[model samples]
Target: MDYEAGTYQKLPIKQYPARELGETAEGRYWRRFLSPATAKQAGAVNYLEFCPVRPYNLAVTSSTRVLVYDGATRSLHRTINRFKDKAYSASWRADGKLLVAGGQDGIVQLFDVGSRSLLRQFKAHKRPVHVARFDPGRMHVLSGGDDATVRWWDVSEGKQVSRWEGHSDYVRAAAVNPAAHGTWATGGYDHVCKVWDARSAQSVLSVDHGAPIEAVAFFPSGSVLVTAGGTQVRVWDLFGGGRELACLSNHQKTVTCVTVSPNAGPDSSAAPRLLTGALDGHLKASVREGVYELERFQVTHIQKYPGPILSLGLSGDAGLLAVGLADGTLTVRKHAKPRADPAKAGILVGRRSRRAPALTAATYRYFIRGQSSKAAAKDSVIAAERKAALATHDKFLRKFRYRDALDAALSTRRAEVVASVVEELAARGGLSSALSSRDAAGLGPLLDHMRRNINDPRHAPQLAALAHRLLDVYGGSEALTGMLPALTLLLERVELELRAQDGLTRVQGMLGPLLAASVGAC
Candidate 1:
């Protein structure tokens, strides 16, 4: 159907089923999985981090252990145990060979991924360490703790090189500047986000977010910073006098974690995308162009979990997204880009091919004869078969053979024929008998057709009647289990529409008396 040039095509709602609906291409970019619970004990997942380099293993911290799983397969590769207390903030070094984690025992532990051995342990803080990360150079580690101090440690010596004591509350968020040497950022319960340069003993910049900061991260270019707190994710431009660039407030609860893709940038061809997780079990991904504007930061996708989101991690290539939940469910989703449909493109090519030919008359005639004969013959055969099938279908309908008519219409998969057969059966009061006698195997296609057209205004009453009869016969059978979700969703929508219609009728009745009273008063 033709529409205004800038308008989008209005797709029929019935064309998309509950299982096949998504903001992006359905079934292309997203999938859900519940990680094997046997590998890790029952506890809230604390953090999830993917390796920065090759193999892209995922580290999941829960209870007292850190579990590593293959990124592609989600199979448990190894379990790093021996934590004296609950573990939190599992991070990977740049090389992907080492891992660092902070725990409730007031210690920072490092593990060698290749050997699965404890490489070093630093008794770095007086209280539990809440967040940790490796510096850009990988020579030192940065950690924040409940002791209200940001400490730096030399990995080789396993000793604290320096510490920054400024925040008066627990430091729960930290990140290393990817583009700047000797620079890092941190946020804490003190409601402040601070940026520090290692060359100096004090913070170089500070911003008051007006709420307790829960997570902080730097843009890939290191020219801007993102901080999450109470339901808001804010971006600041470091090079532009630390100007507040954008405030993204999409979550309904406290924002728990945030991460950015490594390839995201302001000047690159791809728009920079940000991923944020909140305590309300909502994960949102937003994108912005090079020109930073408050209204330009648009939400692209949102995924819901069963429990509060505790941690979020984006793969280095931005192809995989890992999410951890408070209910101990870990989900990994792969990002997919929609590909152009070759069938539609071929149709467009055929349309354009109808213009005048560029070849000589003799050449065109020769090629046309070679192609047209086979194509014409194939088209003629298909047309003849369709005509015969329609004749047979019409003969059954004329004789009031609804059962055979329905079978023929279903085989053709034509909406008009199917709807006519169903309507006719319902009008004749034979819907229940016709549907109930069919075997379970044959009932699937018929039920699917009913589900799709049940809410359509012209045929809703008849389709709904047919649906109830089918459910009555097959609701308890195992064969219907695979179709249960779709059927349930359709029925729920029908119920909602019926309630809405009832409410509208009541409103119209009340308005009639009010209108009459107003006329009398006038």
Candidate 2:
């Protein structure tokens, strides 16, 4: 377990895999997970949150762009071109289509899903709106900021309707309880988690944490409130008549934010999930037992990573996790395996002692059959399938032994797999039914592979069909690529098409590809 501060041990989790836990199991895992790698020197990741929508959820990156990825398919749909600023906080409305985000600039803007237009702009707070959340109760929107006030915005008229200025310092986080409609809560550097009756803008309850509370939220039932920061997560039991229920300590650095599992609704048996993002560079999810009892063998499960995760959001099915780090990196991580058998893994039993992996083959065998259950085995099967596809792709290059390492890794089958991944991504937006999503605005990585096919008019008929389809979705015609040939042809085709046409004006610019490495003597 040789883990140290500021470094994450990329543990070998044969997650699906008795398969590809990592291409190099210990240091790297998926190729794309490391594609948008962080700089050696990282930045301060301010916030991380997720939309409550289904498969594809929106996450905010430091580049100020909002990235959407599908939890089920493990692919991304590029919308980095949509939000053109440094976003502080982003959230989806209860219905999932309308998205609202704010930043240090002190203005909060709402985008309508159907029109993609700014429906309204309201100045809810003056000192840079830090966070804004829509009340699931359909009452009002709650927002907090450096101004030290939590304001309630009237959703119908687009104006500030009420405000509660209580804390002496800046507000860092906020949450709304769905069960307790017309109610919400806030956490701040003031070292307090305050519950407010959203209907009245009045502070109803306040709990003091020993450190600044970086994140806060009420559990699904509104009976308990959880807040975390400085390596501890404190749960307030309002159900216990305002008693402190439990405190969890595992994070190596300051805990950034904690989100409950989307599927942990009233009737679910799976434990309540508490995901913690850390300034120490990792994100881990721990389930709550409600009564402070650990299960059979080793109850706590953790996944380590190599970035300062500032934010985390759970997909609607709780099947996927989106982690946003300070490095301007957005990673869509698969959720950890289900709880391990406590009776199988020897219990520490009331003591925080070391946890050991079974040593004997008999022990390993006992653990393996269970540890690598149908789910774990399922991961292996997926990895094997992907590996075989990759091998088939490289077969031609290896027989001739060209030695061009790049060609050895990038193969035709791999390219086709990328297309399938893209289609899966576009399917989330219901884009797979048409040619538009399959061609552009599909999976970002998959789209990269298709760019080489742009010139073939033989590919042209499909490209034209795809372009025309995209025009129908986007309602305009502009080449996603900057090349003169493509742009010229796209414009002319748009005019000639008897049916409607739509397209991108140009491919969106990348954040840092053109920049030289930094020299650090300042």
Candidate 3:
């Protein structure tokens, strides 16, 4: 259970179900949708969540700080700060007015959307808080941390309610079923996700992933639960008291996170919609029903990010998304129109700068007028907002519109977000080497994504050798060439993380191309 500290030896990973894709009616439906999306230049994304209150909008991710984008306007509204030490995992509260994030410091912080102020910060856990969620009614926030603790906090009072302890190691995940109250789930290093009564601290169920359970979610009806692990998705009919209903497989890497489709609602289709993010940087969606549809299991698309994804949060409107990466890039994303003319695209490539944080005005007032009157209560609150904004640093991170900023970055190949990611990787002892030595055994989704990309001569070449390595180790590719540009940039952005190291470097060996390639590795 003490895996991070080496109390437990590394286990050989096995990505299972061993299914490629077989077409059916569902497969055709997916391909139809995918084709349109791809035609619109909408690539696969890493993380997605619908806003808790609003159904139409969402929060989507790229590789850098969160974005707040409007689905209708397709324009970014704001950005959340890139937490300096680590990526910030988020969940909107039931009201959709507040967003909570568990960041590197093992602290759970609250952001007030109306005022754009970091409302609170609490030492929520001993180790990093990997996952966090707010109670359905907005009275509480639940967080699972590396300390192997599941915590419930009184959101209104800003006080800790109780801490539940059962797992012997880091608690990797936690979730609240929207259709139920006081019922939640937590998973972690112990290789199981425990469903518990949030109020009573009573364990209701524990399901095995045969390895660590990375992520979990509930269907809109709360009748089924979806879990991600070992490249497959296991669906349990909670309606039948946690009976295993179906095991879905198609990915080629360790499944890192899962979420129900934004369309999950009472009147929605009986077929559940599922989305996934993984180590290979591919984001996929599937429609699961009575029987698993193989073609639907096929990855819808790929959103390229360098390194394993750390966390995901969808906006309330279902129009925006927030994705956090181990490399320190937290990206927010959404749908947008592409340039009609490539030559003129350069004019508005980078995001048009936004108005400075309103707090700057407050700071100016505080310096000039507030200093004249310490008795003014408004000055105190304004000063706090200024401090929080300053601590937040990047405009992209300060605004809640993180997804919009990411879209802007993607539009222009903006360098700031990638630069931040590289710095984090460097500090973490060079992520490339860690990835190389990971022993890709059991990474089916990753291999699947990669192998598919390799077959494309435009971006990726040398399919045979890469495919062989992939099958022999990870067994398939979960990524593709579409995301290569972003992945490459993500790696470069964070390469500075290794800058301070003493000649420790990354080593990647690949030939120019395969014999089948007519073009040079162009």
Best candidate, lDDT: 1
TM, every model:
0.60, 0.53, 0.50
Model 2: which ten-residue window has the lowest total lDDT?
A: 513-522
Q: Could you report the Cα RMSD, in angstroms, for every candidate shown?
A: 14.6, 25.9, 29.5
lDDT of 2 by residue, 1-522 (tens): 222322322212111223234233211212113233222212344554555656555545455555444445555543433444566676778876776767667777776655667776778577787787777854457788888888878777998988897887888898877687776778999998888886677888888877898898777778878888788777787756557777666677999878877474222345466667788876665656534433211123465667777777766665455666666566665543445566678766566756676667767565556654566444645443222232431332223232222233234424333333333334434333423433333323223333444443334344445455544554543434423344455555545542332222122233233222211100
Badly placed stretches (over 4 Å) of model 2 are 1-48, 70-85, 262-269, 290-299, 335-522
Model 3's alpha-carbon lDDT is 0.56
On residues 1-522, what C-alpha lDDT tens digit does candidate 3 reach at each position?
A: 112222222211223342456555434433332111111112233344556564434443333344455544444555666454553456677666777777667888877755757887777587877676778878788888888888889887888988887887788777777788778978787878788987687788877766677888887777678777777777776656777666666556888887765443222332455767777766666665334332224344455666566456544323344555545454555533222653355454447733445555557654565456456555545334222222211333234333332233233332333334223333444423323323323233333444334323332333233334433533344433343454454345335434633234322112224422422211
61-124: candidate 1 lDDT, tens digit per residue: 9989888888777678988886989998989988888889999998999998878799889896
Ranking by TM-score: 1, 2, 3
Task: Supply candidate 2's per-residue lDDT for 66.
Answer: 51
* RMSD after Cα superposition, model 3: 29.5
Compared with the true structure, all predictions reach lDDT values of 0.76, 0.59, 0.56
Q: What is the lDDT of residue 70 in candidate 1?
A: 87
Q: Which candidate is the best by TM-score?
A: 1
